[model samples]
Target: MKLLKLVPDDTNIDFMKWRKIAFGISLALMIASVVLVGVRGLNFGVDFVGGQMIRVTFTQTAEAPVAKLRDTVGALGYGSPSIQRFGAPNEVSIRMRLPKEAEGQTGAAATMTNAIVGSIQKDYPGARVDGVDSVSGKVSDELFQKGTIALLAAMVAIAIYIWVRFEWQFGVGGLAALAHDVTLTFGFFALTQLEFDLNIIAALLTIIGYSLNDTIVVYDRIRENLKKYRKMEIGELINLSINETLSRTVMTSLTMVIVLVAMLLLGPETIFGFTAAMTLGIVVGTYSSIYWGAPILVWLKVGPDSFVPVGDKPGAPGRDREGYTR
Candidate 1:
């Protein structure tokens, strides 16, 4: 029986051939992402915005009346409520932001939850209250601040670690790729107006780790090849390293994407944004490892001589295009 190969062992695609174009597109997207975030902004959920969340199930209905429920809740003078089905079709989660004055009042959330639940139970009998949750304005403000700090801290720490593990240039390249992945994910949420919450934070952190792992793999190969082929041009050497790791990269990314896509289509609605962010991360992370991460080495002056000994150049060894000694 023969084994499968998504990328053949002898493959030598010139990934760097599109480095300029890729970076051009990346710059445009990053700038656009910033603009989108600034203009459209993120649609924060109850977790960060401090709100009353009520969960209920309509026992008699096959599907929750989303439109009617919206109208009913909207008329409550509680403003618009964010409602979405979670597990079963009859169940839904409703989130209502608290007013500034109401935030300081005790049992305010409970009062609002009771009112909404009462209205639903009266109009539609057999409505069962599942649970209620609340967060104070101060608490949500703290949460938002802490989440921001956590993301920034994680990215900076990853950059510092890469700098220590590899070189400053590699660290810069890795960090740039991370920023690109994260920023674009944020942009997607802003554009689509998905609920940005603690779950999305976890997804961002996961994406950082994923992008870093891919960067380290390609950088490690580049380092090894630099020492092995001391006479190879930096461009060709970087291209070789990327192509060498292309098979593993493609396999790992494909596997994750398949699982994530499945989750996105068939999984629960609560994790939809999480899955979407990861799906986008896998794609951008793989691309950065190839085009953005590896090619940046050339611009930063990394070459075959980078890993050479301090004293003297070693004897020139004749090597084939595949990086093997002749």
Candidate 2:
């Protein structure tokens, strides 16, 4: 439901002021994210970092305290284990990076599990070793390669689609805007050391889709305005196009942000990474659609005369209700 209107009318708004403010804000956030990325690296999950996941379940609700369980696992010589409550207080999961000595053993998975299980049993005899899984370095490498390929393929496909649907300049601007959003998101993730896993990849793709969709809306308006505002300067046309579509952009983005915020509050932790990334993307996407996307069209020499005619194109419509001919 529409809670409240976020943006007012598009008519007679200060285009230059808003676009400049948007650009400044986007650049500032992106730069801050980059600095953070440089200072703190991303926390790659077991899927990328290569580790073991140990799950334990107690027979009864009052079996053992979480602290006791962690202490038991810690004494096993597992280095820096991440302990978290899984399904319930009685269920706990711990993930730890295996020692370098167990790197390439043929049955490294079973060996690691057995070692951890033996240690856990020594402390808590009643705790059940629910499951143990090992992720090889080779597997992480494979996943890294596959995730890269998927992201590149998506970017290429989107560029091609936009180019085919609109002009070459439109496609280029759309891609630039997409890159801005992705890089900013990555910067934020890296700075925070948020676990980069399959879920993060999913979030990146969702951002790509969201950013591209925003670009398309603004581009559609630019295309329409080019035909209507004949003799208008390129910057003026772009600014006007953005202003014309501003209402729709804010409305659409606000709705999605509302849903995403709900998920952020009530969603499972499994989806927390994805939701957070998308939430940032939605904010950046909205800004880029008007600032980054439209500004690029101006830089590319796209002008009103490209779509409209001074007199008439070689073969196109004459004049219309707007007095602009295609």
Candidate 3:
């Protein structure tokens, strides 16, 4: 579990220059992503957009791959099918927009299922259709709304928790960083034209939790340092806090990125979007912790006075490295 060693001494690293560069890059990417989202939009899955999903398993390993199956399914008078491997090589899932021509028919689902199975059989001999699932447009819409609300609820809860844990300023800065990460991740999806599905929503929530954890660690260090060095310039104090926490921050993020990268490369295609979003968040969250959250503390003019003990002079309780209450 110890993938990284914690640095014992705080190294004074000047991250302001890197912060500027990071800001410029993230801003440009975010704007481009927004534009892509507006113009091209995300490739929504059947769960978000109403469609028919058929799960088919081959009797043996599929001689014809999912791409070929998609092509064959498209030739059967259906729209381009979204074909992807399911649990195993023998299992594949296909989703297609519901045919308008079958709107009112009682056996539309059955008819669509049979047609897809027939198409698979024709293209790849010995293919067997396991099951078909259909969701009406209304149901999909409801799920989308529910997922959105849940995300909003989680953000609110996190903000309140941070506010109670530290101060309103810390809460505000942490929330801003959280929003930065989430928006940038959304921008990536929009820019990349990746599929937006229920799993994508889950990935986003995971990002929120992770980004908050990063922000909290930095904020906690800043709060502790603020009480230790009361008269130092706010900017310098913030910079020093970033340096103090930099080692831990980088080590944690780097480890997470390594795991996510492996999953991105070797994991199933179904989670490609999810893992990609997480990978992006891992990088963004780390940057925001320093550049986004730390700068906010500076701009807020936070100093040792913000959390100084009422009965003692500033730095009076500053103990030695032993951490005793002086």
Candidate 4:
């Protein structure tokens, strides 16, 4: 029986032919993403913005009283609480916004959190305050700073590694692709106003890794082709390399997206943001690896000669018609 093939054996697509179009679209989206982030800004979660997150479980109940809890918390003068079921139906995370007076005051935030917990326990005997997190303004700011640094550091380090492993041109291309993926992710958050937390940071890091992995696969093939196809034009060589790896890319990305889409539709509310971010990242990463990562090489003047030595002549002896030694 013939095996199922997503991308055929003789797959030959001219991805390079549309490099200009891809680059233009990427540039415009990147600029627009940057602008959205600057103007609308991300809706930082309690992890980044100072606040209290209290985890509660009702041991005897099948589901927590969301409406009553909202009213109870609201009546306590702590402002309206954002409550959502996380794990079991009876368990939930209650997020309370830190008041202006409580800003930078860890003691005040803690006291407020304790009071809310105390009120819930009194009102419902089954209520159990499992966890309480109180982050001060200063601490949240520090966390935000560290998260940004981690992202930038990871992207730069990946680029440098690709440069050493392949070529400087590949490194630039990889970095550009990473930038595109990350910028669009941030843009997504800015546009949706989803709560940006350390969890989302984790998602972004994962996206970067995915993007790098895919880009590396393509870059590796491109490098191999450069040595073998000395007579091939740069654009055509890159197109061939991408097509060669297209099957793996499609299968990997398709499976991943299928799982992510399922999670988005059926997963818990707690991981909704995380799943959503990753879903977008996966798609954006794959596109960048194909379009941005491979095409940039052509524009950067990469050719078969790049892999050849300074004094090596065309069709050197011992080399096959394609160029590499037999």
Q: Evaluated with lDDT, which candidate comes out highest? A: 4
For each candidate, the alpha-carbon lDDT, in order, equals 0.86, 0.77, 0.79, 0.88
Which model, 1 or 4, shows the larger TM-score? Answer: 4
Candidate scoring better on lDDT of 1 and 3: 1
Clashing residue pairs for model 1: none
Which should have the higher lDDT, number 1 or number 2?
1
- Candidate 1, TM-score vs. the true structure? 0.81
Pairs that collide in candidate 4 are: none
Query: lDDT tens string, model 2, 1-326?
Result: 85654666636565655666777787887788777777786777777879988888876555446666666667767554666677866787877776668766777657767877787766666778788777778998899889989888888889889888777888888887887898898897887666678888988898889889888988888888777666778777777777777888878888899999999999755567788998998998887777788887776888765554444566655764346545
Residues forming the 10-long window of minimal summed lDDT in candidate 1: 305-314
- Which lDDT tens digits does candidate 3 get at residues 176-283? 788788888878887777878888899889989988988898888887777677678887877787888888788899899999999999986657888999999889
Model 2 stretches with alpha carbons more than 4 Å out: 1-4, 18-40, 55-94, 99-127, 262-270, 308-325
TM-scores, each model vs. reference: 0.81, 0.76, 0.80, 0.85
**Which scores higher on TM-score, 2 or 3?**
3
Q: How far in Å is the alpha carbon of 176 misplaced in model 1?
A: 0.8
Candidate 4 residues lying further than 4 Å off, grouped into runs, are 62-93, 99-119, 311-326
